[model samples]
Target: MAQRVFITAGAGGIGKVIAETYAAQGAQVYVCDQDHRALESLRDGITGSCVDVTDEAALDDWLQAGLAVLGGCDVLINNAGIAGQADPVEALDLAQWKKCLAVNLDAQMITCRAIAPVMKRQKSGAIINLSSTSGLFGAPFRAPYAAAKWAVIGFTKTIATELGPYGIRCNAICPGAVSGDRMDRVLAAEAQARGVTPQDVFEDYASGSSLRRFAEPEEIAQLCVYLSSDAAKFVSGQAIAVDGNTETYHSV
Candidate 1:
């Protein structure tokens, strides 16, 4: 049987690549994202709905509807996230912090909550949560994003232990400075906050990694496919980094 895979925020960026990669491997891919146009533009093998991950009710609805169509989910990837406000901790806004946590952290919990029962009954499934290198190290200007990502690692491990008896595996993927429009926007924001050119900020980020370059979206997507495959059935509760061996975090 073809694998049934569900992904959040799969309409664009890294999520899009992940969805497409699964589809290419003949998996039944269903995704949800906030961008209606991106959802509409998805290729034939991939299907998606417009959903704001922060909206719990809407997210639940999307999951239920997807479950109905896919029959059952073999893999669930929590890929929705935002690069929250780029500012000092003292200058941060409470609303922005909440928003970041809502999408990056809360939504993952919501989806996992909804899917756990299904997986438990099947006695086999994979859950991949997208974390970040920031989760492993201190991200100077991105407190909310970093905090939420750190929490994802903890959440992934807890669930792995809780679900292991039932044959469910959970893991977190930590990608650093992925090369994409999203990273472009993040660089622009950090640059503006630091009063430097975007190029300067980009260089700093690249330099932070031992590889001295940003990761390709396909690189991250490939890992998602691997983790969800039978090959990685024993790999649970691991916070794997795809950041080209990050040496240091860029400073403000």
Candidate 2:
């Protein structure tokens, strides 16, 4: 049987690549994102709905619809996240902080809650939660994002233990400075917060990694595929980093 995979925020950015990668591997892929246009742009073999993860009812509807189409989910990738505010903690807005946690942390739990029973019945499944290198260390100007990502690692581990007895695996992927429009926007925000040029911030970020460069979205996407495959059947409760070994997150 073709593996049935579902992804969150899979309409664009890194999530789109992950979805496409699974589809290429002959998996039945279903994704949800808030961007209607981006969802429309998805290629053949991949299907998605425009959904805001923060809206529980809407998210549930998307998941139910996907479950109906795919029959059962063999893999779930919680890839929806935002960089949140690029400012000091004291300077952050309350609403923005809540929104960050809502998307990055809460939505993962929501999806897991809905899918756990289905996986339990089958006695086999894989769950990959997207974390960040920031979750492993301090991200100077991105407090909310860092906090939520850190929580993701803990959540991943906890669920791994809870689901292990039933043959379900859960893991967290911590990517660092992935090269793309998203990273460009993140660098731009950090630059504005630190009163420096985006190029300078970009250089600083690249230098922080031992590889001296950012990771490509394909790199992260490939890891997602691996973690859900039979090859990684024994890998669970691991917070693997796709980050070229980050050394620091210093500002320019």
Candidate 3:
């Protein structure tokens, strides 16, 4: 049987690639994104909808509807997140902090909560969370994002422990500077704050990793697939990094 895979924020960036990858692998994929136009553009193989995960009611409705169509969800990828602003913690906006947590961290809880019973009934499931390198170490100017991601690691472990006996495996993918438009924007912001060009900031990020390059979204997608497969059946409560081997979250 084709795996029923549900991914959050799959309209673009990493999520989009993940959705396409899973679909290509013959998984019955369902993706939800905030961008309606992007959702419309998804390949015919994918089932998609415009959904803002920060809205609990909307998220629940979408998940419930997709579960009905897919019959039951075998895997879930919590891929929705925002970088927030490039500012010191003291200078960060209160509203932005809340927004960052709303999507990056809290929304995953909502999705997991909804999917728990279904997976429990079936006695098997896999959950892959999109955490960040920031979760493992200090992210100077990106405190809000860092905090939420670190929280995700703890949350992932909790789910793994609680759901392990039921055959539900949970893990986190902590990606380093992913090469894309999103990274470009992040570099631009960091560049402005540090009085350097975006290219310089980009170089700094790449240098922080041993491979000295950005990780491709397709690579991350592959990791997601591996973790959800039978091969990784024993893998749970692990925070795996798909970075070019991220040496540090800090630029230095």
Q: Lowest lDDT 10-mer window, candidate 2?
A: 243-252
Ranking by lDDT: 1, 2, 3
User: After TM-score superposition, what is the CA distance of residue 146 in candidate 3 from its true location, in Å?
Assistant: 0.6
Worst 10 residues of 3 by lDDT: 243-252
lDDT of 1 by residue, 1-252 (tens): 999999999999999999999999899999999998899899979988899999999999999999999888999999999888888999999999999999999999999999999999999999999999889998888899899999999999999999999999999999988888878887898789899999999888899888999999999999999998889988999999998888887521
* TM-score of each candidate structure, all chains considered together: 0.95, 0.94, 0.95
Residue 246 alpha-carbon offset, candidate 2, angstroms: 1.0
Residue 146 lDDT, candidate 2, scale 0-100: 91
Q: Cα lDDT of all candidates, in order?
A: 0.92, 0.92, 0.91
lDDT of 3 by residue, 118-183 (tens): 999999999999998888888888888899999999999999999999999999999887888888
Instruction: Give per-residue lDDT, candidate 3, residue 180.
Output: 85
Give the alpha carbon lDDT tens digit for every residue of 182-209 in model 2.
Answer: 7788788879999999999888878887
Better of 2 and 3 by TM-score: 3
Model 2, CA-based lDDT:
0.92
Can you give the lDDT of residue 124 in candidate 2?
A: 99
